[model samples]
Target: MPEFAEEAEVTADAKRAVRVAVLARRRASTADQRATAAARVQAELVALVRRLRPRLVAAYVPVGTEPGGPDLPGVLAGALPAGARLLLPVLRDDLDLDWGAWTGPENLVAAGRGMREPAGPRLGMTAVAGAELVVVPAVAVDRRGLRLGRGGGSYDRALVRVPADTLTVVPLHDGELVDRLPAAPHDRAVRAVVTPTDGLRTLNGKPGVVPHTSAGRTGGQ
Candidate 1:
């Protein structure tokens, strides 16, 4: 698919912003600063989880170069309901990912490209098609719901099979939410945004509006 020129510009700017933020985060002189940011981000993630309750959640385990810190594991550990089945992505040789269940932190093992993946049985791409919510990691997101992902385009391919109404979301630090993003035809638009301090914001319309419908389950085109 041809890339969207406007989307590309939005993505480039978003990447620049996130790269700067990551650098600043890495340069914090004191342990306290790093700890504080982690705690704040965790709190925001917990709030987002609460607001998205009862939905089958598909979230990622952070990798070395990913923007979100180690907070994701801890947030998933504490926030997910007992009855809720947590799903994680498993990258294949082709750079596409398949879904699997995460029993707990121990269920994750080191995978190719230095990523941590669930040890659970492969649940196939169709599993993603069934999810009610999918929390994706992005380099940046614009007001129109365009998300700039890491260059691999793995999520874009994986998401093509997901139900259209699924409450797809991308979580970033506060400033990662921007006015616009670079979009491509293959790039998917998420329904919401979750930030370290903002909880969850519906992005299909107003910035702060919370979406009321249960995440939709229509498979990707």
Candidate 2:
């Protein structure tokens, strides 16, 4: 039992180190670079929406220096087919995520944790299960689709509500996609990643198919 606890601690430390490094890199990015990455990421996501034609999409508004840029919600709204709805995450007190509808930029209000969330009525966590496509945020993702988040576990909890077959993706800056990342038992792995330079790359051979198995060493390996 002690050995298992120590192993978990080591994994947490590794993830923290990676998070610090990645956030530093993001902080150093100039406005122009962020703009360019934003454009590219938006383009890729737009393309994905077009291809999937999802009647409902679950996504979030990116905060400062986060990938997908501040304009992402608007960009996605423009790309989605008419009458289709966009759901943005609302952070709950327990750090779990509740969903809300993205009506427009004006409807988005400043939220806790440096986030911008929809001001509309709250949708239960299970709303994500109804989305045909889910776009999440990641500090980084490995080729195996193991995601490194900000350690809040908000998205991790929300992701479990997503159907295994629903298309889940993350948008990243050019080099944020790496060979591997540390994972814990509750961590969720995504099916694909979208980067400024690479556009979209599916980790699973088949696109949009997320393996229900956890990505930690004891599980995925």
Candidate 3:
């Protein structure tokens, strides 16, 4: 097991490095290329969300204009059902995010790091703990369920607070998913992954397929 873990870590690091290089090149390309890729990625995210239809999903809003793909707002608008209440992470002063419901794009306000957030009432830690599904952002991820985050550890901290039964997923571009990722003891593995091509599936560290139904559209689907 220790050997396997070590190998997984090395593989994860290599995967992250490759993805970083790819994204850097993508960002440096012509404006038209970036726009076209963003559109494609956005369409993929929408399809995945529609198929999964998670209840009580926790997702993040994008900051800056790096041009990775469509931002979270577009993904939410395209994928979420009309009555489905989408949750956005509101970055607090202390570097923690307060989960809030997004009624629409107009409900968002500029928050920490210039990320857009829901203006709804702040849901306490308990509300976050009770979520049915959590959609995480990643710099990159591997087939082994290891994710490379933005180094803030905010998502890691918040993830630890969520119930074990909640389906944790990381959505990334197709090329971002690779064979492995460096894992730490404190790092948490998501239950599944959603990519531009792949809709959803169980991750390496977990078992069974995550059920997809629109029933828990409010909080616990």
Candidate 4:
């Protein structure tokens, strides 16, 4: 083998550095603070579900100090109206995501990714397109809606399937929502952010550099 240089992207190293710093801060939080934040996050998520009233919603299970906690899906389930559904992601070996219905905590099963996923029917990856609302996990997000995700690049692939007008939400721990971060054209932006302290707020300005038709709408996304 000759030389294996880093990819030919200026933001690659910058993004990696940002991710490391952000995750470090996240892992540094005390258990008590995380617990308090989890309660606040659950309340905000409940309020969001009531406001959106989505018949189908897509969400994720938190791993490590990532927000949302373990009770999110169950809590949202109770908040939803009868016949409504909530979807949780199933991590594929290739890091792409499949969806499954979240029935209750009893149905949660541990996965290779260190997440507890709903042991329900496997919905194809494109199932996310049908969700009226999507709540994703992010390492950090900026005021302009630019989201910095973990290096896996799974959400980037699935997000393309979301409808243009559908809302994509990311939950952060207050300070994690910043003014800016390392971004390239390929990094898709989220529309709104829900913080433990601030609750929910829509971002200003256009979404991160991307074709209009490809980026899902942020009209309160």
Output the number of the lDDT-best candidate: 2
Worst 10 residues of 2 by lDDT: 212-221
Q: Which residue pairs clash in candidate 3?
A: 12-180, 12-181, 216-221
112-137: candidate 4 lDDT, tens digit per residue: 75878889899989999999888988
* Candidate 4 clashes between residue pairs 3 or more apart in a chain or in different chains: 164-217, 192-221
Pick by TM-score: which candidate is best?
2
Candidate 1: where are CA atoms >4 Å away? 1-34, 65-68, 206-221
Q: What tens digits encode model 1's per-residue C-alpha lDDT throughout 1-221?
A: 35566666776686667656654654543555545545655565565566667447788886543445654765765677778877889988998998888777877888876778888799987688877778788767787887777667788888888887777877665567788655656777887776645555677575443434222211111
Q: Estimate each model's TM-score.
A: 0.75, 0.92, 0.72, 0.87
Prediction 2 global C-alpha lDDT: 0.85
Q: Residue 52 error for model 1, in Å? A: 3.9
| Candidate 2 stretches greater than 4 Å from native | 207-221
Error of 3 at 11 (Å): 13
Q: Tens digits of per-residue lDDT for model 2 on 77-184?
A: 898898999999999989999999998898999888988999989989899899998999999999877899999999989999898777898999989988989989
Instruction: Please give the distance, in angstroms, between residue 211's alpha carbon in candidate 4 and its true position after superposition.
Output: 25
Native RMSD of candidate 3 (Å) = 6.2
lDDT of 2 at 53: 74
User: What TM-score would you give candidate 2 relative to the actual structure?
Assistant: 0.92
Off-target runs (Cα >4 Å) in candidate 4 are 1-8, 206-221
